[model samples]
Target: MPVAPAPPAAPAYADPQGSLRASDADRDRIADILAEALAEGRLDAEEHAERVEAVYRAKTVGELEPIVRDLPAAPGRTAAAPRPEPVPAAYGPEDVEGNADQLLAVFSSTTRKGRWRVARRTNAFAVFGNIEIDLTEAIFAQPLTTINATSIFGNIEVRVPENISLRGTGTGILGNFEVTSLEGVDPQAPLVVVNGYALCGNVEARPKRGKWVVDLQSKIRKHLGH
Candidate 1:
């Protein structure tokens, strides 16, 4: 007798507010779940990559439900969990440490941003080019991070989270070395040190701010005069 394959497992729970927006942290959590599944032999490399990509592409909590439906829940967490607040997009640098340690821009431009792991010490070089290092959406692999930069006839702009602590010192020979003053910054936060030289170029660092997103609830609230 021909028998059909068993049906896929059902979701643990119903998604009540499926339309609710998702956050970076939520996506990261889903990715973590997928990674564990891959490590446990439940998913292959190709499947894991595809699922991880879907996680980043997801726009709402409901969209993430199916990808991890058959996988085990994360430790200390449930299979059907509420989305947490967004966190800086960063991952552990254990595997990538000592790999791709430098960002060089030669007569061109380079950028690093969005859910990336930054090494403990990184070098940013720009020669007649532009280099942008956006750590606002990045994760630091260590508690202390040092970015050594060198810009000659080029520009280097770095953006960090507003709550993180910062310490920097550099020289600009016929160029500019400008960093935002740290006021009301958290003292216990991770330390980021930037030191380098800029010749006929610009090196600037500033805080990152959130961009507004329009949602259905916001529109409803406006109509209701809330």
Candidate 2:
């Protein structure tokens, strides 16, 4: 797929609700293809619905980051070069639909502003961008998932579900997180937690009971200048 030039600083279109239209076609193409899988019987009805929810409703790549980050590595897709800098300039979709077993993946970046949400879900999806999501209805996810994200000067509020295994968490100082259920971390998973200046976010996880084998934390220092 070809990358489109970033849209104007401010868009000219508006939806029926009278707000600016933040998204366009390129964002939905991958999701549309994922949706088509339903007719081909490659995805079960439930799977089809999940994928649809992930692709259509998710507003930006960040909000949808947890939506779809695991795609089967395209035959020609190369491995992402190891990042040598403390904060790699981006959180690119090195693995967009990069793995098969991993059902969903969302890829996006924020150079401006936008709004997105979950429309439907079928198989899985991929989200990437800088955007915000309002919690009106509900959002669901598959068993195994990966959401690689980066927010330069924006925000991402993820409404998580009950059952699922999370393996990775990474963030930068420029980013701030307000997770509601900090204990939601699935203990069955070998949770790899990492952050810079995350705030307010909490987790309510049903961690499998066991001996005290995992515990970790770190104090964050503020940057003197923006």
Candidate 3:
């Protein structure tokens, strides 16, 4: 029957293993490698940030291969030698006193701005109201701060500094939950994790324009000097 229309050519990949789908653990491994590369001066801040961002966006194993092809072999893989641990950066005091752990807004707008201390975990609830959390000038008392936001027919907005990493694992049901994942240059920068749900409402976390953690390294140095 017309020579069976000839057999279709098979798709190909540089490495057969690359054709596999990448799991969350695979992405995490790659991120760790990039962090190590950044710490070891193998890759600059921009490169590290870009690669890390790509790592999160990668869908298939093939997509992750090129990201770390030039870098040293990842852990558990064949390598000439083992990699060394990076020195930890000094952090400022984690002032948890007087920090608000729960923010509720019902039919009114609630805003948390200016200089303040961020607790290890904060919950924001907006029921038929609005809640705003700005961290550009806020102090982080922990390396990892989690924000649990719930919006029921309302809105919750979170603004973060540009020098800190941001992550979101929220969902939306007949609503919108959006968070732009960002990887900051400083490896020691605090990580802000947003996790919650939006029910017929909206929740968003993003970097405020022209806002950054002023002199992060200098602040760390000053903290160490004390």
* Top lDDT prediction, candidate number: 3
| Ranking of all candidate structures by their lDDT, best first | 3, 1, 2
RMSD of each: 17.0, 20.6, 10.5
Q: Model 1, clash count?
A: 1
| Model 3 ranges with Cα > 4 A deviation | 1-91, 95-100, 221-226
lDDT of 2 by residue, 58-116 (tens): 55544443333443221223538632222111111223343322122234432211222
Model 1 per-residue lDDT at 20: 67
TM-scores, in order shown? 0.50, 0.24, 0.60
Find the 10 residues in a row with the least total lDDT in model 1.
211-220
Candidate-wise lDDT, in order: 0.67, 0.31, 0.78
**Cα lDDT tens digits for candidate 1, 52-117:** 657656899889878888877843346566544222222244433344369999999999988677
TM-score of 3: 0.60
Residue range 1-226, candidate 3, lDDT tens digits: 3655778667674546666888755765676567667666788766766776677668898788788878886533576787554444433465435243899999999999998878766889999999999999987765656688999999999999988888777789999999988877777777676878999999999999899888678766765575
TM-score computed on alpha carbons, candidate 1 = 0.50
Say which prediction, candidate 1 or candidate 3, comes out ahead on lDDT: 3
- Give the lDDT of residue 45 in candidate 1: 50
How are the candidates ranked when ordered by TM-score, highest leading?
3, 1, 2
Off by over 4 Å in 1: 1-100, 183-187, 211-226
Model 2 accuracy (lDDT, Cα):
0.31
lDDT of 2 at 171: 36
